[model samples]
Target: MKGRRRWRGEHRRFAAVLVLYTLLLLLLVPYALDYGARRGRADEEPLLRRCPSLEEALSEWGWEQRPPLDEEEEEEDEAGTAGAAGNGSAGAAGKRHIYLHATWRTGSSFLGELFNQHPDVFYLYEPMWHLWQALYPGDALSLQGALRDMLRALFRCDFSVLRLYAAPPAPRDPLAPAPPAADNLTTASIFGWRTNKVICSPPLCPAAPRTRGEIGLVDGAACEEKCPPRALRELEAECRKYPVVVIKDVRLLELGALLPLLREPGLNLRVVQLFRDPRAVHNSRLKARQALLRESVQVLRSRHRAEPRGSPRHQQQHLLLPPGLLGGGRASQPQHRAEFFLGGALEVICQAWLRDLLLARRAPGWLRRRYTQLRYEDLVREPRAELRRLLRFAGLTVPPALEDFVLNMTRGAAYSSDRPFLISARDAREAVHAWRERLSRQQVRQVEAACGEAMSILAYPLSSGDAR
Candidate 1:
């Protein structure tokens, strides 16, 4: 009896040990997989990774002495050729993909229009907006991978990805006929499709006619009223016909998130990053505050979740900045919810811009050739000259009609504030500098405090009051 009792006790102990071991494996396996994935991840490295070259360059050259575009191009060209042997596959494909990387109220629409008006380029305006809309309340950081995947598919003229988010699934029971079909996505499902030149013009829509060698903007209102929605497959066919595909998006917050797409050899991807004065961007964001509130919240949520108090990197980033810059529960304040969320988002934006600037400054030779940065102020001030430089970088020659259109658009009759979001010709100079008149001194100071480091790098001088 004593021996049998001892055997039962040992069996219970062995079973308990087995259960604990199984639980540990279940928990540790996922963590191991995640760690391994991160180790091999091709996206941007840690934002705060030390770059000795960047530090030395900044100390020696000062902020205002950026290498001239021409000089930089020459250097990149010389270095790019060493790796050109492997790039022939993409070149032979005869499809060049460009992403206009910009955020809200940064003259991005105007910049995107430059490609949209080009007859040989198929431009998609904010297609990823569908993803953000479909996944509402999803943080911007979390959705970046999805954004890249969507871009990958779109660049290849594959419209099937759109169905994943654009169309709601049909009901399981066909006889009920209560819900929309799974394959119901159409041209109109795209964000800003009415203004898309390819969608508004021939083959897809008969609302506006296209002629050979024509470079003109599409009429959004007319397209909306007269054009019938076409199937997603039709848009895909039209996309395949173009040699250049340009996608403009404001949701991509960091250059690191996009490095994978940039490194993909088959895509032949190039990036044109557009930047505006932070103050001006903030002012415009406030003007459209209600419309941008959701996106602002999304961005702020990302910053909060990404930066934890225990992190050494997070501590270093906040050491110099003022308190509340991270928007910690600011949504609960007495101020407008839009202002609170937008304010926090601005800090994140500056952080991203500063990081991107540093990364670009120290980028490898091949990446340097593939990436170029543009300032909205400079582009507006020298429309013709800047346009030529921009076209050159994209491997495109300037057509006389496009040049004339750009000049006319910048030299508008007068500056109008009535329709801030509408894409129309405006007095570029006045529009660029309007922040001086609109923002309060305190507001300006806040922006300078948040963006001083980036503003300095971009050669935007501090206000006379702040003086460094």
Candidate 2:
């Protein structure tokens, strides 16, 4: 009996040590990852961040910087055979790059606004798109160093979203003793608008939601007496201390072709795909281009006639219900089907959209698993529910402050018509149905026939008329 008791005690001791060992490994992992990444040699190490280095991420889309390559860099380029490959110089871990994959007019602006409100989220008003909108029209030259600075801004904003995780920037209390090297990091105004694209917003005039291609100067003379290189080095050193960061831009969805160049596996990014029904989308699109919407109506009508019914590649086919059916079918107006106007360039857009969705669905399972899908209906109707899900998706907690704000904001929602769709439970359910009233009968039929496969997959009904 004495020997048996002694043996049991020995086993218990071994188990306790094993548990402690596992705990130690768990606690040290992030630090180990953080340390190994930052301290590694710069020349050969690939920085592992979540954001990709794409042309959209660059100041110039697809324009390679012709920095008078130093003899050594030129030799490296020759050995690599082209500029297509990048040197392993910028390897940092956990850099979050967020691309809002959304169709135009899908309440994307509102979504952007929500993200911008997060104190930690460095809200960029379409960082990658200035090249096409402001810079190109203004004919700004994309120089090598300027381009580098542009990337630095992208990187800084990308990392700043990990606001609490990383150490705060220097000069926090400039008079105090400097923080430890392990705890320091650098962030530029791109994280804080160090250099922002000069938006020509008329006083109180809501800036048009589009990128302007103009050469934007570093705001307030980053050019005049810029922070010293040694200071920047110190900043990078501190930045390296954190394991992860995040950056967001909605324009990447507009320029879908630029995706490959932007994907950076070293960054460990999680991509989000957001979408909304087309009629609402088109309505908003029309609103944004009032004159064009007026002109396009005639064109849209003519184009609507050319497409055949019962064929594939249509938009908003199944969700249409008569106006009488709206609001528990109480109102007196006859609701028409939205798919009735489903052809021409509109059809083209719808079809292209479906294609992108399919491609996004099939993206490498690795990226696909990381990709999250959110419909406008889900978010607007139950902001708290949706936000909670999103927090879990991002592995974040639903802090009390955010929870309180979301709860209050969603309680007495008035989103429809003006905000529309997002505020009402009926609109949320009938979101895709807007096409019934918005589109012609033929347009509805044609779109239904065309996109039946995708509709089924997305769990949309075929048509309201089928019930009759």
Candidate 3:
């Protein structure tokens, strides 16, 4: 009996020790997860490395090193200056390239259209779309590099070269399953445009074929006939002839990554940084997530009906569905995907806005001169005035045609934000403040908590509770 009691006591002591160890691990788990997340974010973003000495320049925008102008570019600049001195038309001769920097769901499509509609402006809508597809869901740094490199090529009018870096669209059969969002390389997926405007544009292709309506589609015959591969010299000449080239990309929220391009010689680079209310941005992103999820399910279902159930094609289609799209062997609802993918939506949007704003604020005077910051609210509130300012900044005259286009574009009843391709100014005023109704008080608070400082800097007022 004494031996039995001693053994039982020893066992009880061991059990207690095991329980204590488990409790300790549970207590430390959250902190450990948080540390890992922070470390991962640091590795992914590395904002400090991208813009060294950010603290010193936070108060005032300054650069550590100025990009040196190459000898050839310097000579070209001098020649351009001399020509400007002799003729008043020299300003027209100097081509302007504008970068519309924005974040997702910030009304960038509308802003891009404003430039695209202009006759003199050769607008490339989201050239970085290819880059995103090429580096889909990769490290943030790699995406940034791809964005910069692609922009460099596009600005230089090197269309043939971009193909090297960008992935070719994957082959699809009528019965094949739609690729996951990351792998989808349709024209709309790769170029962010429903039409092949960039490929068929006058700068890259012959102008005569552009008159045909069907040329807008990316048909092989139309491309071969209209966009016969031009030599580099011819492409460059066409680019020089254009007064302005506008490239709008929402992925270019990282202003620091674009500093090098701002300093590129001969090519005049200007930036229009567009921002929207953080709450609105978050809400729009959620809505977009839902739309994407719905579209994915429909496509998957259609593909399922077309292909044999147990065939290799069906199996391939099943595999193509991203994990986010699938839940328990079936397509998940949009809300489920949104919740799973974007649980911290408010924080993510706020952080992105803050980072972009901070980077733009710290830009040097030279870059700042070329940079224009516009709010979506402002654009919607006074479309005419804001557009005039934009045109002036872009060095484009407000022609009567442009004025009419703006008026019609903003006032049309057919205009809806949901339809990206359709140019409509309908409900412009309401769209600016729609977030008030869409975002819950809790959601607003979350955004305000993460972005209070940025909001203040950008002149966005916070609720009393959210005020710093």
Each model's lDDT: 0.76, 0.42, 0.60
lDDT string, candidate 2, 76-143, tens digits: 52343222113221122123445455544565544554443343233354444333232332211222
Regions of model 3 farther than 4 Å from truth: 1-53, 56-62, 67-93, 165-240, 291-334, 343-346, 414-422, 464-468
Q: Please provide, for model 3 over 1-468, each residue's C-alpha lDDT reduced to its tens digit, 9 standing for 90 to 100.
A: 999999999999999999999999998999999999999977773334443334433323234367435557645654664464345342543777789988667788778877766656667777765555565444343356667877887887766545554545555686776544432223333344333354455546555355322212334456556565444455456556666788888655357677678777667787898988776676666667764333223222233222223335532422222244544543366465554344243343444456566666655556666788999888877788898788777767555665666666556553256654344566666666566767666656756655566788789888654322
Q: For every model in order, what is the number of clashing pairs?
A: 0, 50, 2
Looking at model 3, residue 386 earns an lDDT score of 90
Best by lDDT: 1
Better model by lDDT, 2 or 3? 3
Descending-TM-score candidate ranking: 1, 3, 2
RMSD, every candidate, angstroms: 11.4, 24.5, 15.9
TM-score for candidate 2: 0.45
